[model samples]
Target chain A: MSEVILELDAVVKKFDDNEVLKGISLQLHRHEVVCLIGASGSGKSTLLRCVNLLETIDQGTITLFGQSLNDPRIDPDQVRRHTGMVFQSFNLFPHLSVLENVLVGPVRALKRKRSDVVDEAMHLLERIGLSDRAKEFPERLSGGQQQRVAIARSLAMKPALLLLDEVTSALDPSLVGEVLDLLRDLATSGTTMLIATHEMNFARDVAHQVAYLDGGVLVEQGAPDQLFTNPQHDSTRLFLERVR
Target chain B: MSNITDESVSEERPSFFVPRRKQLLVGRRGIVASTLSVVIFLGGLVAVFYLAPGGAAVRRFYFDRHDMWEAFVGNHNAGLSSVGIGIFTNIWVFLVSEVFILIFGLTIAWTRMSKSPVLLPFRILATIYSDIFRGIPVLLVFFLVGFGLPPLGIAVVSYQSVAVYGCVALTLTYSAYVAEVFRAGIYSVPHGQLLAARSLGLTNATTMRRVILPQAVRTVIPPLLNDFISLQKDTALLSLLGVIEAVNAGTIYQDTKFNSSGLVVASLLFLAMTVPLTRFTDGLIARDRKRRLASS
Candidate 1:
């Protein structure tokens, strides 16, 4: 039995009058890849933000490793340390070098020794094959290269779970392959991931489980093969048909 | 087929003669007209300087090269030449108050931007300080801090020199203006940058210092330099506090020599300093524009 790393039960979030995520319930287990798929404004990105505590949930609860996140006693920063999120826009610090961006998490947040973190930062950059561009700023990099650095930055924190929100949607179609290949490799290496993405083919190939969301509701969730091909809900079926 | 394609391509070419000739004629006429206007204006001014009935007086008071020299370097009782000491006084007050304004303005800006409930009172105080100081004329602030403080017979302030009083007044007034500049710069940073930093587990203060401020400060440099240029000129206002800076020195020479050449010399000195700084700021703005265009 795999340990549930993250679980949401009836989590609801609203912005002013708009209910972005309504009574959403989902779970992610250790070493598992879960993909959330839906049309624009369907609460896919909002759900990931709520889990990371970027957006506060208006009701229900989020639990990580059996700890309730709704408690005010829990610091959002502390929660974020255990869960890393990569943005759709590849939000690398433009002023900092690639290596410094990676090292900011470990050295500034975690209070690790600079010398120790420098080696780890270089090792992470090496893994992404961006070791040569370590000293270059984000503005100098291509979108694909920058997204890879963003992932390396998150991975440097040694997060227990990673959340990717539309990571490849902003990239050119040609550049998308490199980042998707990187994610495929990360999955094979057993990194736990929760992704909100529009890449149905990528989700079909890489996701252990796929969940369909429609207008702030989770319509259906199951193994990728079952959900993608044999969706039990009409909404999921309509969504799959449209995307295909 | 090749000859037919060539004929079609040649037929599609637009004529370049009529509009090109019109543009050339307009550009040449504009150049000649501006050149003639500049020459006529400059010649008229020179004719007035040399041929008017009061030309001799004008030369003696405002254009006498020797009087200008004497007014700039004429020694006062303090042993240093008037112009020498005047430049020194202006530089000293400008540099000191500049340092204070940078620190005080950025602190006040941060205070106003703070969101914590515990800091609400401080935020209101910062807002009031900026509003009141920026609203009042800087000359009034000089009089108040310079003259008003000493007569109250307060211990440390009462014993301070007139120059120190002027420095304090300028710092207070300009810090208010600069604080608003900094606040605008800080807010100009994209909200997404803050989101990205906070999502990485960095605290609010850490995010501001590391992510936001560096970018904000870069964007504000041109405007900050403009403020400093104004501050450099405002050092003359210190003369009202009996600080004996450039304008005061010029006034002394005008009174003693019964000529305005000293005043003209002082004006020229200020122009000399300000013009280069103005050009430098323009160059910086042009370069920044080019960089933005390239990146976009």
Candidate 2:
């Protein structure tokens, strides 16, 4: 087996009086793709947020490359530097042009020289097929284009792990295909990713491990063919039935 | 298949074109509306101002052309400076105070918004400061800072010039109001922006300076300008502090020449400064709305 890039051991999270994530455990190896499939409010987004340290977990440890990320001595910002996240809404900095959005992380956060990063940033934009729109603001682009720019912005950081939380959930049906296609290419190129998605077919095609979550509990998880063909849990079968 | 074939045969495509002559009718209606507005509103105002019973006496006292030009050029006989020149003092005070207000306001706002345990004490202090300054009237703050501070024998606070006192007072008061505006702008930014910035490993300070503040400042420009317009007018309050600003200069001329036309000239100068800023702010708001509509 490849080296583990992420390990969640019975991680738990809550909000006020509600338990959003109930002792969920998962793991991803380097160059592996893990797709978390769940209904809305099934704690999929919250689980991804925990891995990124955007939300602190209530219990259990999240280990990243053998480092205990939840340790008090660990700086969340330092941990985040090694991981990149793409939100549901593009959330591109409206004041920045498309090229600047991809450049901001390396130049400002990583302290790379702008001249050194400009070529690589342009290459990333070109890969997304948006080099021509480099000078335009995010709002000027279509929803699919903006989301692709967002993905490119994250990729610019060259993070060890990428967390995508329902990236296509907010996109129009016609636009979802473009973003999913980009993700498919990323998966093929062996970028380690933990994606929370609603698309069953995309999950089956791309994910090395498919985890079905129902109401914050990991109902069943396995290779996509096995999980889809024969879910061990009644809830998992029921979910697949309804979604299909 | 049969229904689709029948529908395709009978379907008529919608026309999006409008005739040029029909479009011209909108321009004609606009012209007529403007003409009616001018005739009713502007003409009515002119008649009321010139045909009133006390019109002659009022004109002689307030709108006398000789007094206006004399006041504008300075009452050389009375050894008073021109109201036009005195306006420069108000402008200087406004410009200096605005710089300080913007810096101090953003600092206080950032301090108040910080969630770090290290900033707790500073946050409390900032909150109290804003609360006290915003709760009291600006005039009272002016009196307190202008009349009350200097007598305490503090070296930095003991400025002799009334204009210096005016600048200090204006900065202290307007900074509080502007701080609230900045805070509102910061909050108006969605939480997702903060998350996105943090996920990129940008430190809080860097995120705020590079990402958050640029967006916040853009969102708050119109309201910030509104505050500045109020601040510019309030510079006239410096006249009460014995600063020889435009209004005070006008008062000196009125005392010497026994006519109020000097005050009219001062009022006109103030309107000239403020109206442009007001219109500019309106244009910004309209453009922002149009941009939002277009994008969404």
Candidate 3:
């Protein structure tokens, strides 16, 4: 087996009186793609947020590359350096040009030289087919284009793990294909990714592992084929039926 | 159905359809509205100048051309400076105070927004500073800084020039208001931007500086300009401290010449500065709205 890149041992999270994640455990190995499938408010987003350290977990440990992320001694920022997150809304800095948005992480956070990062940043933009729109701000781009730039911005950091939170949920139906196509390409290239998505077919196609979550509990998880064809839990089967 | 086909054939002539009539910059309705506005404005002026009781006396006292020009040029015999020149003092105080207000306001806002345990005490102090300053009337702050500070016998606080006192007073009072504006701007930026920045491994301070503040400052530009317009006007309040600003110069002329035209000139000077700024701010707000509408 490949090296374990992320390990979640009975993770728990709560907001005030309501628990969002209930002792959920999962694992992802190097160069693996895991798609988290759940209904809204099933704690999928909260789980991703916990792994990114945006929200602190209430119980259990999340080990990233064998480092205990919940340890008090670990700087969250330092841990975040190895992981990149693309948000649902594609929250690109409105004031920055598209190229500058891509360059910001490497040049500003990583302290990489601007000249060194600019070429790579442009190449990333080129790969996203946004090199012509590099000088324009995010507001000028279409929703799909903005989300693609957002992905490119994260890729600029060259993170060990990428966390995508419903990245296509905000795009128009006509625009969803473009973003999903890009994700398909990324999956083919073997970039380690943990994506929380509603696209069941995409999950079935691209993900090596599909974890079905229902009401903050990991109902069942296995290879996509097994999980989709033969869900062990009644709740997982019900969810799949409802979604289909 | 036949007419529809005819319309489609016409549409195929060219993608662009030029209207038969030239588009008028001002329509007939616009012309009528403008004419009505002009009439009402002229009527109001006529009533003020001719119909009101004491119109002649008021005009002689307030709008005497000779006294206005004399006040503007200054009366050397009276040892008083020109109101025009005195306005420069107000401008200088405004410029210096604005620089300090912006710097101090941003610092206070940064201190308030910080989440680190290390900044707790400083954050509390910042909160207290903004609360106390914002609660007090600006004029009271002016009095306290202008008169109270110099008596403290501290070397840095004991400035002899009333203009220096004015600058300090304006900076202290306006910084609190401006700090709140900055805070509002920061909060107006979506939380996702912060998350996105932090996820890139940027520290809190770097995220704020690089990602948050740039966006925040853009959103707050109109409000900031509004505060500045108020600040510019409030510089006239410094005249009470014997700073010889435009209003003080006008009053000096009023006392010696016994005509209020000098005060009129002072008001006109203020209006000249503020009116353009007000319009510019409105233009910015309109442009911002248009841009947002287009993008959304």
Over the stretch B127-211, how does candidate 2's per-residue lDDT look in tens digits?
Answer: 9999988888878877887888778887876856778888888988899999999999999988889999999999999999989
Cα-based lDDT at residue B251, candidate 2: 95
Question: Could you tell me the TM-score of chain B in model 2?
Answer: 0.83
Inter-residue clash pairs, candidate 2: none
User: What overall lDDT goes with each candidate model?
Assistant: 0.89, 0.91, 0.91
lDDT, model 1: 0.89
Off by over 4 Å in 3: B1-40, B279-296
Ranking by DockQ: 3, 2, 1
Instruction: Please tell me which predicted candidate would have the highest DockQ against the true structure.
Output: 3
lDDT of candidate 3 over B1-296, digit per residue (tens) = 34465544555445464453633325685677778889999999988888688988998999999999999889888786699998999888999999999999999999998888999999999999999999999899889988898888898769568889999889999999999999999999999999999999999889999999988987899899989999999999998888888999999999988998999999999888889888987887788656644533
Kindly report which residue stretches of model 2 are placed more than 4 angstroms away from their true locations once superposed. B1-36, B79-81, B279-296
Instruction: Tell me the docking grade of candidate 3.
Output: medium
Each candidate's DockQ: 0.53, 0.54, 0.57
Between candidates 1 and 2, the one scoring higher on TM-score is 2
lDDT of 1 by residue, B54-173 (tens): 998888878789878887887656332476458778888989999999999999999999988999999999999999999999999999999899889979978899999889988999
Query: Each model's TM-score?
Result: 0.88, 0.92, 0.91
